[model samples]
Target: MKQTIRLEQFERADIRSALAKMNRGIERESLRITSEGQLATTMHPAALGATLTHPLITTDYAEALMEFITPVSTSITTTLAQLRDVHRFTYQHIGDEYLWPLSMPCYLNATSDIRLAQFGKSHVGRMKTVYRQGLTHRYGAVMQTISGVHFNWSVSDELWPLLAAEEGRENNADYRSERYFGLIRNFKRWAWVIPYLFGASPVLCKSFLKHSSADLDFHELSSGMVYVPHSTSLRMSDLGYTNKEQAALKITYNSLDDYVDGLRRAVFTRSEQFADIGVQTGDKWQQLNANILQIENEFYSPIRPKRVADSGETPTQALERGGIQYIEVRALDVNPFSEVGITAEQMRFLDLFLLFCLFTESPELSIECQQATEKNVNKVVLRGREPGLTLMDEAGEYSVQERLAHLFAEMAKIADVLEAESSAYHRALQSFAPAISNPDATFSAKLLRMYEEASKIFQHVGMRFAVEYRDRLKNSGYEFYTEADFQKMAAQSLAEQAEIEAQDKGSFGDFLAAYFEQALDKKKRA
Candidate 1:
């Protein structure tokens, strides 16, 4: 039977007090490419501090790709303001290099042209680089270049204790962790709504399809852009980060222990396909190992249970020590229209949506339900706004509009508990209603129309957005971090990086062996 949750479970007076203290953080990733629309060949800017040690600014898979992280804040407005300050500060440092405004890359000549992010001579630093080497060997560098935003969210500590009291349970990490897992399961079931509303990458440069034998029915425009009509986010589809090897792993999220066990096994178990590639060709190291995953972070998912790791503690170890501190939402595309790639309205809606996931009574997800969820997500990513589209529930198939309307209605109840001014959340739902009724109002459809009107020149549109965003940031002074604050952070990060490099006394080979053994030992102890 489908689980049902009553609104009366959260009486307004009690829930309203808790809602006012929730925390949120955002991590946005963007590729830094040159002015003429070529991938940046330059090293990460020295002015930006060490990528390995910097708290706010860091490099992702490629040296050219930059990721900006905001410190956790209770106010949604404050988090976004901090993100904008990071952007403004970064713009001052990256001379002539434009942050790619869209989720997809602008242009690429070859895979070799993209450089894996490099770190200095620390054992940990080397491991980070070697892991990227594994990723490039496992998946092409072009796929790694695709960028997106990650939203990290959590309720206040007081709120958790209140929830535990209401449930007549112990206010401990175990209870909180289990509840967070329930939220994760519900997110998996309903997260299709995210991509349907915010998906922005409906098209790609033809260069991305150069080497692969992907059988996408791409329609080519006169100016050389390829797209699948009615597609919402090609970035989330098979053409982007989807891998058959990882898919075969069947990672489950029914509980914290089950999820962690699946991830642990995948990391340790060697893959024949990767083994054939070999870990080393003579003296040079090829990858961390021939395992399905080099580390826990490599197990990509739409959402993850997160805990702030202690000094020298692994991600899994942190979770083992203290249950989940927050959940990271990874499904959002970089909204091309916004200067900072995300807006206050989007964040507000996300807050409501995540709360809905938490409040809803989530049933234990069976393997069949898991597969159904995947199907629904795939349908939304590819053709969400197609006229009269439908998604499957355990009961049967239903129209997407009907499903969304029901979801919005539930979300409104959450909004009331949040004590939010109804406009932001209400307007978001109302605006999305049109996309359900008419496809052209969707981000993908509007983007495609822009491309058509611009004579099919994708680069032109992308470049225009890039320049406009750059100027916007350049003109706006820092709202959160000051110039002195950035300078201090950069210097501190450099010192930390140097100290780490100096502290390393073991060979890379020995370090790798110990890392794997330690993780295995932890799992056994648990």
Candidate 2:
């Protein structure tokens, strides 16, 4: 049963070359704010490009919430440089608005102030906006406005053959998908370390709680700031992305089929709660449908298996045609200390952790174990920096400090092999090793301390970083992409969006029916 490969398995040339050439991409979201530190009421800047067809820049839930995407590359420094260039280019077009630095948002009065992201007149573009409308009706706009960074990672194809041989399985596409699922299972079991080491949202503005119905005990601070003591990231807590409705779905990751089938079922399954909201009122559509999910992406998780879908193809359809291509890590908070919301060291650490996950023993995750894993993450999100905190594991309860040390020791072994090509892997591990024993040295702890020293005014500390980063990026200029390159891309995106609109030939109802029909057809084939 222990046929899993060891850290010492990198002996062959193919394996060694594969280990050195893993690819990574980044997607970071930040809200546009005014000089007074209020949410920008303006529409998405036209100079950036159409939100629907843009390759590099787009909008998230709100019109003011900008999402920047970096193309995939093997080098971590290049990935970071692309992100920085995106920020620098955006600053030039945004006029007076500053990109909000913290994961938590600025002041807000009500949901109406937060406009849904607008796409062009094309059917597909309209569907994207309608999805956001569904989210606002279902989860409220405030919660959806919280931002974070997503890391998309995949190992080399050559490494997969080595893994398939070690497991005594055929070197096929399905085996690759299954092994990626195994990595995901292990990632869930040990993901708490991420928020502990890189979390930056220790406090939030009181405006975030204006529409909240949940009863949470929080200490109030001056200037409408409120927080839980010693919390690492309230953004990852129940207050943020943790949704009760999706939690009830219990999507399993035992295999690729299990994962895909669960998402498809959830999309088709009706929900009484959503039914009450109603799908449409006359010509205006309020939401997509009265289902547990509007689409596959509605079923939220800390991580997801992803494939780049072709035009008119659903995410599940793409996965069915081709096995999982990569895994997107969605647990990271935007690091306020960095101009780009993430550092090269953080990316290197993630690479080591993911490599460790691939090589570690990953058992099938049961329902009870899944719940326990979630509880572990929740504890870390709320009280990770608290002294003597313990978490539940398969082997009874264990102190977080002890578990982190053991995990890091294991990661160091993988880093040892990886550093043969570049010392960046080992250097990144050493950078974060101190946070294991000394909780005060962690990012969350430092953010909390600075917030308190600023007289408990959340924005006092956040706005400072926002202003500083804005000026630095504006003056630093571009790192990778030139101004002409950005302008051409933006113009081309707008032209592509216009062509899509011009090519429309069907009614809105017909378009909706066809889309749903395709989804149902894929499920039937599965």
Candidate 3:
């Protein structure tokens, strides 16, 4: 069966109207418990934002969205404490727990335009990841190339539960639980992402994606997850769900039978499976989308290369052949100080911001675009907000701060359209505009202001995380660290790597050359 996914935009009437209707169910308070198992009475809103809660969604007064407001929260504070406060105010739903440490954002089919965010057909092998050992969803599985554009809606369908379902919080006479969604702005360490940025992926993120109840003749099952023997490797071709012919003829994650069926399920009639016609994203929505392109540019802020085939082929011809069709947008910075993670204004702005990326309508970068990206990165790092810091023109030609100003003005107009649609989205847009206006609003500057220096920021956040983890483990009566955890894990891992390298029997450059050779060979075979 042939399957294609499309980004589905909702009409403003439908989008806003649905949100408005849903407003009746929005909770204004949090519902969490103290270690004593009694309600924590003496707490501030920021306290609620920082608390770790379970059961993803809730209507409890202790962990409600309205309790954390995104409507009117903008400040010039740089301390992690303050940033954390605002973040908590925005994303009380996704607290520090439940953080999935994956290199890329979990791929969620948002509007049809999201595919455009990945590029129509410019990403291929990027979609699939292969571990040195065979696995599909862990350290080395294909991540559906989804880099996030900050200040936008979340990009995961899994969010439906947190946003719509009240998981726990039963037996409260004051209120009834309803499906509720809130901003999720917890900024966790991104070790999973470090490898990707360093270009070590399709090699790391391939572990288990599914669990089978039992083991087989080739492998044994343990702890609900199928064990992958260390002796084997899972190739990219092994993960392709393109069609039956490309399936590797062997099931790795699940039994061959189960794998084949799962593939069918993910692809066949996928349109029907994703049948939730978004409430309504109308003309105003499109206006808000395209307009975001004019104002604040966010995509240009982050660096991520979209891997395309070196072979010369027209975009049209490549699409026909299912060639390079991937681009991962990685500009979003973790709201490093937020309790909840991020804020509503950030989310709303992001919705428009992402559309802007998709609609940038850019093709292959001219030397100019490449240089522009380099210049922007430099400016962002050192002089992000030095009055009239310079940037490139839309044509990627001349360098001019006036051009940057002009771009900002145009983007502001788009943001205004978004503001016109819903007070929620509009307010969110206006709230974050100041940050976009200067470096002070960016996470980096705020971080500097917080600790009074870069090193201090790291120490403070690091200590905070360390303290939190210690407390968590202590509370759970668990071991936080051991000799193996501290030292042996790394030593053992490196030793294992040495062994693998020894068995491969190649020099460093030779290994890289050999890897490419095998990759190309596999591609040609497929």
Worst 10 residues of 3 by lDDT: 180-189
Query: For every model shown, what is its TM-score relative to the native structure?
Result: 0.96, 0.96, 0.33
Tens-place lDDT per residue, model 3, 98-182, is: 2211112222222121121110111111111111011112112222221122121222223223323333443221111111000
Instruction: Tell me the tens digit of each residue's lDDT in model 2 across 1-526.
Output: 1113375676666676778788999999999999888999999999999888889999999999999999999988899989999999999999999999989998887778898999989888888888889988888889999999999999987788886786689877688788889889988898788888887787888888887764666887776778888788888887786556788888889987788888888999999999998987877988889898999888778889998887788898888878889999999999988988999999989988898888777999987888898898889988989999999877789888888888788777776676454577778888888999998888888887777778744348878988999899899968789999999999999999999999997977689879988887553222
Error of 1 at 131 (Å): 0.7
* Reference-based lDDT, each prediction: 0.84, 0.86, 0.27
Which pairs, if any, clash in model 1?
none
**Candidate 2 overall Cα lDDT vs. reference?**
0.86
- Decreasing lDDT order of the candidates: 2, 1, 3
Candidate that beats the other on lDDT, 1 or 3, i.e. the better one: 1
Poorly placed runs, candidate 3 (over 4 Å): 1-326, 339-344, 360-364, 394-409, 412-421, 436-438, 453-461, 465-518, 521-526
Best by lDDT: 2
In model 2, which runs have C-alpha deviations exceeding 4 angstroms? Answer: 1-5, 166-168, 420-422, 456-459, 523-526
